[model samples]
Target: MDLPRITARRSEGGWELEIAGLGPAYVKRLSDVSEHGRTLMQAAGVTGSEHGVQVKVDLGDELNERVRSATQATVDAHRAQLEAAAEMRRTTMSLRGHGMTGRDIAFILGISPQRVSQLLSSHQL
Candidate 1:
């Protein structure tokens, strides 16, 4: 991003904005994002012609690590689903090659005959 990043931490009364070169500034809770940006700009001494800054909210180290871990778990679950689908498609093709009927393959894989037909017609599953 082109804007400078400012760290915001929850504090008594409102929040604490830590600007890189300029230490920390305390601000009362604002109603909207733009208002917060405007207040941050004034505290950081940004010129009127310049745009607003980027604010990074800090919820503490433990909470941040939990958020990251949850995000990674979601990504890993999606990847596993994709891999399982691919493996099912490969197994279906292999069974069909052994002269097995769609109905028989469906019974073996616990899926419908229509699904077996679909797997046979396309490379993706």
Candidate 2:
């Protein structure tokens, strides 16, 4: 009736687990599970060590969910900023095509000519 003991932590790339008292074989099995993106489950006698002890590891689901949500928020914010910049570029380009000079475009856009040039170059128009 031996049981494995597991402790896990969240990292920037993924989850990390430190299993105490686990044999090499069992550690390999746990590592395999993690590589395949599966949570390690607590099971008895899975390690088959001479000592009646093992270690199980997995990530905290609640924390992972929060991290995912935050990441999505950041991505959305960046997308919005890019969309706004593209819109400004379109407006400035239209005004320039109508015979406006770089200074006039900058004044109308309330930005520098360098910034307008960068945006136009990025859009390739």
Candidate 3:
């Protein structure tokens, strides 16, 4: 199940946190996020592990946003990396079928000759 998230962003002089359904605004330091979140959750009648809150905080806006963006971008990059590897594996097979040598395939694909041989051997598409 998807869990609810609490967003804490850097504000003037400190950090500001807010819950969607709750009316109160919270301001505190980074270290005390869990305690403050717990307190607010209790106040808002959000009890137990079923309703656990996910806190999204960074080291203030400038630093935090960069980290958050980089974090998500890394996930996206990893997915793209996997997809590119699969495409390369398929392309390697197609090249080998077209009477291409391992060394030639490696040079054109920018991979090692040994990698070309491995990709040629594996049929796990």
RMSD of each: 4.1, 10.4, 4.6
Could you say which candidate leads in TM-score?
A: 1
What's model 2's lDDT at 55? 39
Q: On residues 46-125, what C-alpha lDDT tens digit does candidate 2 reach at each position?
A: 45333333434444788778878999999999999989877998897798789998888888889998987886677684
lDDT of 1 by residue, 91-112 (tens): 9999999999999999999999
State in Å the error of residue 69, model 1: 0.7
Once fitted onto the true fold, the runs of candidate 1 whose alpha carbons sit more than 4 angstroms away are 11-35, 38-55
Model 3 Cα lDDT, one tens digit per residue, 16-116: 77666776466668677667776777777774525666787756668878988999999999999999988988999899889999999999999999999
TM-score quality measure for candidate 1 = 0.67
Clashes of 1: 0
- TM-score of model 2 relative to the true fold? 0.49
- Clashing pairs in model 3? none
Worst 10 residues of 3 by lDDT: 44-53
Better of 1 and 2 by TM-score: 1
TM-score to native of every candidate shown:
0.67, 0.49, 0.57
